[model samples]
Target: MSAPGPSESGSTTRRGAAFADIRRRQQATRGRGRRTRSLFGMMRPYRGRIAILLVALLVATAASLAPAPLAAKAVDDGLSKGNLDHLTVLVAVLLGVSLVGLVATVVRDRLVGWLGARLLSDLRERIFRHLLQMPVSYHERQRAGVLVSRMTNDVDALQTMISSSLVTLISSVLMLLGSIVILISLDLKLALITFTTIPVLLLGSLAFRLASVDAFARTRETIGAITAHLQETLSGVRVIRSYGREQGHLDRFHELGDENRRANMKTVYLNAAYFPAVEYLSTAAIVIVLLVGGAEAIDGAVTIGVLIGFVTALDNFFGPITELSNVYTTFQSGMAALEKIGALLDQESTLTDPAHPRELPDPLRGELRFEHVTFGYGVPSRGGSASAGGTGASSSPIVLHDIDLTIPAGATVALVGSTGAGKSTLVKLAARFIDPSEGRVLLDGVDLRDLRQRELRSRMGIVPQEGFLFSGTVAENIAFGRDGATREDVERVVASLGAGDVLDQLPQGLDTEVGERGGSLSAGQRQLVAFARALIAGAPANGDGRLGGPSILLLDEATANVDLRTERRIEEALELLLSDRTAIVIAHRLSTIRSADLIAVVEHGRICEAGTHEELLVRGGAYAKLHEDWQRGTTDAPSAAAS
Candidate 1:
């Protein structure tokens, strides 16, 4: 995009500043719309109801003003001329109009309230649906509390504007206009005096509104901060207790509470001054009207009933103005929330599915290849860091360089390395989580990037070092990879993985709740669940002619957490699962690595040794040293555990 010009940029900045002002004013008004445009936008969906309500409001206004005229007529044509018949008829007409106005007002309130609620529901659902569709990275950067606020408080603020503020604003303006017209008709000079305080009222309202806007915005920010603090503290409450830091956490929480309190007090202070100031101006207008109109009425320039009607109309007019002022706070808060939500919606995901995706053919033969693949974690280089200026140790470097490898279909390969070996990074590259900075990863001679990510991921199974589980039943966790899978399907998978006995031993069999993050399950059980999930996911579809399933199975330290006995059971299941599939196991145990068709010892970002177990042992280089270290560690583990 071309850079904006000074005038264009300046105008944009000015517009932003104006919006900021509006946001502040909106917070002050508390869902009251500063701009008619925003208010109308919210009301647009309920235009029909609003139209009906408007008509009713007009009827009510007309009916209400009608009584004043009848009252005046009752005095002039009945009591003044000693006509009791005229007086009774006029009194009864005034009473009938009052009843009609009351009914109309009630109906108008109901219609507006219903419309406001419906609009709020629709807006909230739209925002939530959009949020669900957003990519993972978008969620990673945003605060949970802020998102909740948008869905709740922000939507609620809009509701207030829709239900009451908007209608009152319109009706008030109409009432004020009608009153002005009636006052003018009665006597021009007196009418001018009544309206003289209007400019001052408007100025005071605008100033207070702007100040209140700032106050409300601060209040909202403080509230959001408090929410975030509380959420974080609760989430890590266990850690806090373990560290004996409860008092420290309480102090921090108190600080946040105090900040929130101060912000609220500031808003309350502004509101206190604002309403009274507006009321004082209204009082001044009333005084002016009475003083000027009293003299006119006494001189017979205006009648007593006309003067009385004008004061009543003026009182009615000021009610809407007061309501409008009250709504400013809610309006400010909603606008501020909108700006935040809008920013989230505008964020573009770095990773996106292609516009026209090419699907991978089924019965995918897992032939993998890496061609001169040089990659990095995309970590920014800082001065004097070992990875900087290519001055790092040969055993550790910034990037994986010129990696060339190929794994034939249905082969089992093991990758072995120490810490900082870039082993996990290599697997991530193979999974296509991150694209290579240079070269490419190929699956069955086709560049992995050419295939749809969804299709690619579905065809492969991954078991991470730490098996993460959601809050659900054991059976639900197992069946997660395959949506709409039946209980029979889950049972079969559990049986196939030899975890049937484990499931039967649970408190409620497969129906037992796993607790959040499978807290109720042991680490070994969690691993087994992940293993079963992977096995079930890799199994062939019912219609497929092929016996064994997934093209590739990527196991990243899959058996690390399990005991030797459990590992042996897992290995047995792995053999069955890997019978006709290519398997790349990031081996943490010598027993697992020894069984592989090929073993590659990765050091730094390159393969230092590659061979079968027997071949690597005979070679006695990096592989032999690693095997020796593993044997020694295994020997020492029993002693350490016993101690």
Candidate 2:
């Protein structure tokens, strides 16, 4: 081709951009179609009730439409002809129609309410199950408030649509269509005149739709933001009050609330101007038809009864329109909510159980091995020498590099390093909380991925920095670690952990409620309970203290916050806890891990030293440096922090 001018180049570029935009829009449309199908597919199980609802709607609409014709018959065939008997018959038929309509409406409401409740329940369960299934990395990047919003605010929008707007939409369409046929059949001329206002209605709706294109979606978004803010505030109220930042948090919450209010107001503004105008137009159509029909009657071209019937039937046309207008808010919000919920449902977890999961070997040794593994959160990482940020296709820094290590069965391996040195990442790999990006983690001889997550988790127990307890008795919280664990089982596990004082300290012993997140108890108490919870799962079946349920125990060093006395008590419990179990502890204090079977010095996603603490001290490498720093800092040795 000859050298093209800048104008030609610009034009070609514009065309290409335009085509790309078209493709994006097409893709979005297809996505929405799929989401819509998924939303309705949730209702498939209740199709039988749906059929009954449909029948009720039809019956109700038919009964509702019968009245106008009956009035016309009474006027033309009964009143005008002076037949009282005929008028009486029409009146009785009218009463019968009202009764049928009443019954149908009741059935419709009952079924709609039932479906609304069922769908809302199912939607929450789906979101919750999927959310729990997601890998630790996915949760690490997402806000708790946003996920809570999906389960609460987004799902509630659909509830409003089901209970209110759904029936209106169906009934209005049927009524509108039914009215048109009756009006045309009654008086074609008058029906055509009444139809003249439809263009105005359509034009108004088009304008409203254009103005409110993304308004409903914006409303949903703002509400979710508000919910997120509120949730965070409530969760951190103690911190806020402690820091004297309650006013600041209140200001932030108000800002979010205002944003939500503004978003909702946009839709309100559109409806305020649009729906009333429709009502006025409906009234105008009535005036036009009545004026024309009166003249026709005076000219003897139409009967008075037909004129009356046309006016009464006029509502059938505008009534559905008004009903739809009334429920438009619910419709739009529900659709917006459906899209959000669908996106959540579409989140495919990388940590799902295998299609054909391998059975866990009986007498599992829990020998953990990481073989040349690599990992990233699929999350953008902060820059520096540590993260190796902007790596590969992900553009997110790798948190773990090619690593090979083995923790033999029934060994206590203490992970020691700096804050971002992939200490927690290693234990997480061993637990299979996340899959390795490049290589595999094996339990015994089998890849972790091959084992079902539930079975794997049941065999292993993790106790983090905070031992989060549910709102229940201390015994109940301990019982959660194992299935069908009785009150006796709970008491025995506590006694075995040497944590009997925790129950004695409680007013009701094991029956005393933990309160939300174990808030009713002290930090040390919570930690002791957590230890018991972990051990109760496959605890010593006999008095000999042999491992039963949980063979692998992951501890994040729960004694860091307590006093020396409590710390010593926890250390005593840890001794018993670590017996015959494969243990990986993220050691915060260097002194605690000196006696560990193995100590791995991790630095910037690589283990620089592996051996006993004494071996590393003799070698005089990275671990020696950490030990030196800890000795200088304090006797507690928190300066040797990991993760």
Cα lDDT, all candidates = 0.75, 0.83
Best by TM-score: 2
- Model 2 gets an lDDT of 0.83
RMSD of each: 7.5, 4.3
Q: TM-score for every candidate vs. truth?
A: 0.79, 0.92
lDDT of 2 by residue, 541-613 (tens): 5566433548998887655655556666667766776767898988767866777899998999998889998
Candidate 1 segments whose C-alpha is farther than 4 A from its true place: 1-107, 367-456, 538-557, 560-564, 582-632, 639-643
Report backbone clashes per prediction.
19, 2
In candidate 1 the C-alpha lDDT for residue 589 amounts to: 88
TM-score for candidate 2: 0.92
Error of 2 at 362 (Å): 0.6
